[model samples]
Target: MTEDRKKGNSSKWRPQTMMVRGGLTRSEHGETSEALFLNSGFVYDSPEEQSARMAGDKPGYIYSRYANPTVRMFEERLAQIEGAEDCRATASGMAAIHTMLVAPIKPGDRIIAQRQLFSSCLWILKNLMPKMGVEVTWLDGSDLGQWEDATRKPCRFALIETPSNPLLDAVDIRAVADLVHNAGGELIVDNVFASPILQRPIELGADWVVYSTTKHMDGQGRTLGGAILGKTSKIVDELQQYYRHTGPSMSPFNAWVVLKGLETMDLRVRRMSDNARVIADRLATNPKIKAVRYPGRSDHPHHNTHASQMPEGGGSMLAFSLKGGGDAAFAMLNRLGLIDISNNLGDAKSLITHPATTTHRTLTEHERAAIGLDDTWVRLSVGLEDPEDVAEDVEQALAGR
Candidate 1:
């Protein structure tokens, strides 16, 4: 802004302002919108310069596999909004998440993670990582006691999701971060559900914060991308090797799409979050719903921690159980007209999903029970619709349409 330019530092700009303008790299023509560098390679000005750039003695793009102007703009803008020292984009949200867990890990290194995570994340921790000769342990993230107990032993990495997927469970980030740090481990937070507009894990002492930019960062559901942000070498320098070699780089085109998404993310998330608050209240009073968990409500078991941890109130995600069980949940989802029944969340359109049958299906009945996910439970990602309309559709569905 003209005022900000006079103030002399972009860092002083607020979150919404940063999201729109932070990572801009104007081309020679200085287009009003960001330019998409769609090519996979850049031409060298000279062989000497190419050799210098290739050898890392200079700063310029060598290959699109690791770096692109459009992707870098998205990374920088998000980093500024999130207050992260640096950021890197990836192919998908899961790519960012899986990479965050595996990037700093190796054989024989132990990792501790919360049990309530997206199924893909669970696979990495419970299935894939163990097969790689790494020891993995799971804990109830809401239980600080469980966190402390698990981190008391020396471990290389600790992973958790605040307001975890579908369930909305929250934990004290600072308390867990200190414990992990004391044990010579790093705390990596997946702050996907609670977008940077609502939470900044880095400010809460997290060593690294990761995002599935596919979700709220690209609030319109236009693209798939992921990012890892931190102020440490582990993310800036070390993780670069893993990202470069694994070929999980994000598309420069998707990055540009997300750049447009970021410009309006502040408005979209806040509106959706507001809609969620209203829908949660309506669901709580419904006779057909057995239980409701929303971070903004005082009745939520972890509402206090959520309030302390997230500067904004509860986000757009909420979970509820039907008094009529899975059949009723499925029927209700089938009846909805305005809301979509999909595995995806964080979209301009409202979405509903039965966690047991979809996102967590890989977990056995026994494993699902262990995590408090049951057949009747449904997860809702509130959207940019009228709150009354969303609530009415849910009510009519619960009432058998």
Candidate 2:
């Protein structure tokens, strides 16, 4: 451990140092593990102290809905890793995204975003906000022309998801951020696909970064949580305000789970990403696969862009199309004995899912087609299993094909 860690000076600690030691508060019992404060409320010495707590004169937590010790530890530790000034943990990924995206723009404000995003995020920008009178101009992220055309005027927020779900479409954050900045908009990035270990969007010029902590942060598929992180007053003025009053707080138990999860996130993400790079390479050469979309692969269209953004490796998720289309895809998915068929990604167990049915099913056929998503596509989240074991299972699934 570094001297910064020894001193508990979070600002001076490195990412790995921050992950292991940041935000740790020990009880009088001197337990090494973070104490889980499971109560709904806190007690004070006197009415004056209670009033002070409620008045924000005191720095302690009043209600679990607004904050909790365990959850704050989780937030502080993540903020340290992510290089953010503040972080707010929420009930789930959707809550983090919704709070970050919805809080800034009122009915008359506008949003410019890519068409390629997690289905639920798309719903917020495409379906939910439109009814409330917010205008969202969807664009193709890969094409700088669309971004240029859309950001010619001012908008409240410009959003992108790098190494986008299922497809792994990596967009240029700095490039888009420059354009958005010129137009006076804050850039919001969904950093879940490329966890903080792989990419820090705030450093890439994103004003706000969001995550489904249930994914890589939890690492074990054991809990539901989300976080929104930012380095500016905007986090306090806009996002935190929405977070506090709306009561989408993360549970202390879940926070404790993720706190433990964070201790090893650096290890798990790197291992899973390594496993994925190997598996993506193995699957790419298979004649049964029509195409492969892993950032580690040289042929991936976004390889260069993704490489710049995610310095560690191509992340653990990959998507490939079956040569025989949907039927062959289903056969391969069903035949895989080791990998489970599930929509969730970023778990310790390798998971495969048909996005056209499970994740992106909400997208209209036209929408899916526009993003080049077809029935043949299957998304894979490589896990921490032995590479050979995982590869053998995948190859066996493709044997007859």
Clashes (N, CA, C under 3 Å) per candidate:
0, 0
The per-model lDDT (C-alpha) reads 0.87, 0.88
Error of 1 at 358 (Å): 0.3
Cα RMSD (Å) per model?
Answer: 1.9, 1.8
Error of 1 at 373 (Å): 0.7
- Candidate that scores best on lDDT: 2
Task: Output the TM-score of candidate 2.
Answer: 0.97
Residue lDDT tens for model 2, 1-401:
55553334358667888888898876667677788999889999999999998999988989899889889889989888888888999999999988887777788888998999999999898888998799999998888999999999899898888889879998899999999999999899998988999998888888889999999999889999999998658777777667778888999999999988999999999999999998999988888889989987879998999988887799999999988989998888878888898888899999899999999999999999999999999999989999778878988998853
Residue 5 error, candidate 1, Å: 6.0
Give the C-alpha miss distance for residue 247 in model 1, angstroms. 1.4
TM-scores of the models, in the order given: 0.96, 0.97
